[model samples]
Target: MTTARRIPVAIVGGFLGSGKTSLLRRVLTGAADTAVIVNEFGEVGLDHQLLRACEERVELLGGGCACCTRRADLVRTLRDLLDDRDRGRAELRRVVIETSGLADPAPIAFTITSDPMVRHHFEVERLIVTVDACNGPAQLAAHPEVAKQALLADELVITKVDLVEPEARDRLAAQLSELNPAATIRTAVHGVLEHEALRASAGRAEPGARPDGRAPPPPARAGAGGHTDDVRTLCMDLDRPIDWLGFAVWLSMLLHARGEEVLRVKGLLELEDGTLVSVNGVQHVMHTPEHLPRAAIADPRPGIVFITRGLDVHRLRDSLETFQRLARAGAGVSGR
Candidate 1:
């Protein structure tokens, strides 16, 4: 029997009035093979209504926010999407999870990776975030959620650029870069982005390409330019394998304790057993770590890049190192 192809999930998120709906509309304008699962906080899902394709299976999640309180609902909806596809109810080329304006991409993404039922069926293909040029700067400055949205983005599309002045646009672009140096930034008009840009933004990796969910770690960078002026990005390179169990426990605990401030965590860790592990998270939701091919794998340099709010990277690195050491010592005891 042929193995079923796993569907890719593209998560679209942004702050309130950030043009998320408009950009989603553009993606579905002519793509008949695509399907969507939209989480609308209101009783009525206007985004689903706007999608005119009769064949497109658009599931609307309303009442509470999908990324937080209603996150379990999202997992159920995704399973349903896969079931429908398996039963020939829908033919889809791609699936997009359009989050509510107030949503964070983390929890939903965590649901996708963390759940057993849908984990193998769906891989997070991309996280696209829209920033309204007119209000993006102010939103980034005044709202922590806005920064979180941007920090979690794989592609940051600045919409309504025509409404803002050139200088303002540049400033916003720079700020976004500071927030997520790894994300590709683009300007959009009327929520329309270039097809090439969209394709690039998705990274469009084949199933095995990014098995670990680690996008190329952003270059080593350190800055405090965004609002709160506390979001610190720390990048590191490690040449040794680590103790996976201990590191996982420690990192998980760290997120539990300081999830609000630990915006984005991307790391490529080498295990003591000579395996390469990719570990990353957004806020409190850690993506399931993946083990890569061990024999002469490409891009073997283990890198950790973080975009955080008031996190002490030095302390974090030291703690991680300590955990790995203890884990190794325990493992040796077990072997004896």
Candidate 2:
């Protein structure tokens, strides 16, 4: 039997006054088939009221942040949206969840993926995070949540660029890149970015895929830019095809042991079957791995990037290599 199509979900997250609602307002204008779930930390949800003018299907989760106290409400709201779509009461092609300013996006992702019913009906398409150009530097230095939000994003939108000087904006962009080397960075003035750029499907590309067909140079070593909280980005290149079973075991163990410290991981891996798989995870929760068509990728070298806190890159690399070697040796003996 064929599987049913799942609704794609886009998560919009950032710190207070980071222009998330403004960005969402622009993206949702004239979007008839999209439903929105807006979370606010107070008893009254003012953001949802502003958003209702742009889209018809808007649900509010008031009185708590979506990442923690209001998580169950989020799940209920999503299931309710699905019910509306199923009953023909709503025509929904996509769902957007606007997390509260102080929300942690990882738990919201985990809630969707971990719920058996919800996971079957919905898939997280992308994580879009906004950063204030004026206050982003201080926020990154002082608030661990803001750094986590930036690091976990698939696309980082630097908002209010006009408020800062050109040099300051450039510096903020560079810092975001250092925090998340794999994410695509864009700038917005007055929360306005090209509509196409804000689309859920626009930013993701195969790791190291370039216009010239040459892999881009590897990211700089961690700590080179002196990031705060010991949070650093690490990039690793795969020299050979990886054994899938071994790779799975290695990742499972790593996340199980040090999940909190490993904030995010993104990679494209070449497996022993000569197929390429894309891996993405936030904290301990991983999105389902995706298989890529061989014809589409230009650079065949497999690469992985990690945004981690207080973790040694060398030790992590060694652990992965050791597991792969052991798996290969076991396969050889079994073959004989």
Candidate 3:
């Protein structure tokens, strides 16, 4: 028997008062065949109540439902949602998990990816983060979670743009890009972005699923121009394949040494064994590398995008090359 197709889980995460609920409301009002799982219903009673108000606005969900729960019961709640959908009580094509303001999205991501039951039925589609433009700079400087949320995002949405001055908005945008250069960034007024941009921003189309992002390496330039002046971006284009094991070690060391400074790493890598690996990481957490499942892709070209702070690209590239050589030599010696 064929296994049933798994549904995708898209996450909406951000720091407190970052207009998370506003974005969640937009998500509810925008789509159909979507189920929503909201956590920490009582922590900020006002926001939960405000978001719950969306139920009345989403009259066209077509029998899909949104349930609110605390953090601890998320896995169980997900199972319940699946069960309900299976029972014909509702129809769900995708799931959207709106985390509480103070919650760390990585753990939720871990729960979805690590739990055997959850992973079998569900796969993470993408992580969309909302950042409040007016207060983002202060938040990033004061709260580490704010940076984590920005770093892990597939798309970062800047909310309440109208409330902030143009300079502040531009600075915040630069900081976000420096933190997650690979992420698609869009600005919104009251959480509404253009439909096309929003759809693209709510990614998880399978990494490398889009044929358009491939590009020539960018010109090496100035570092991240944030208020803090710590973040930076590096884009690399490769013509040759790489040894997977060596690359893994290089990445492990990079994160192990400066995970806090390395905000995000994302790209397509061609492994020497002829497998194409898609990598995405934030701080110390990494999603398992995805090998293409569609078919044999002939293009073995490699490209990598890094978002980091306090590290230069040239050094990173040199160290990686050295490790690859060392690893190959070690393998040869062992074979003898």
Predicted model with the maximum lDDT: 2
TM agreement with the true structure for every prediction: 0.72, 0.84, 0.70
**Ranking 1 against 2 by TM-score, winner:** 2
Q: How far out, in Å, is residue 52 in model 1?
A: 11
The worst-scoring run of ten residues by lDDT in candidate 3 lies at 53-62
**If the candidates were sorted by their lDDT against the true structure, best first, what order would they fall in?**
2, 1, 3
Q: Supply candidate 3's per-residue lDDT for 178.
A: 54
In model 1, pairs of residues that clash are none
Error of 1 at 103 (Å): 2.6
Pairs in steric clash, model 2: none
Candidate 1: tens digits of C-alpha lDDT, residues 61-93 = 333333333256676677666677678877766
Q: What is the Å distance of residue 86 in model 2 from its true position? A: 1.1
Candidate 3 at 24: error in angstroms?
2.0
Number of the top-ranking candidate, with TM-score as the measure: 2
Question: What is every candidate's alpha-carbon RMSD to the true fold?
Answer: 6.1, 5.7, 8.5
Per residue, candidate 2 scores C-alpha lDDT tens digits across 1-336 of 999888888888899888887887778777878887775335223333222212212232323322222256667778777787779877778888887676678777877887789899989878999999899888887777787788888888989988889899888887777677767778787668732332111114621242111232354543323345577667777768899999999999998778877888887788998988888888777988988887876555677887788898878888999999999999999999
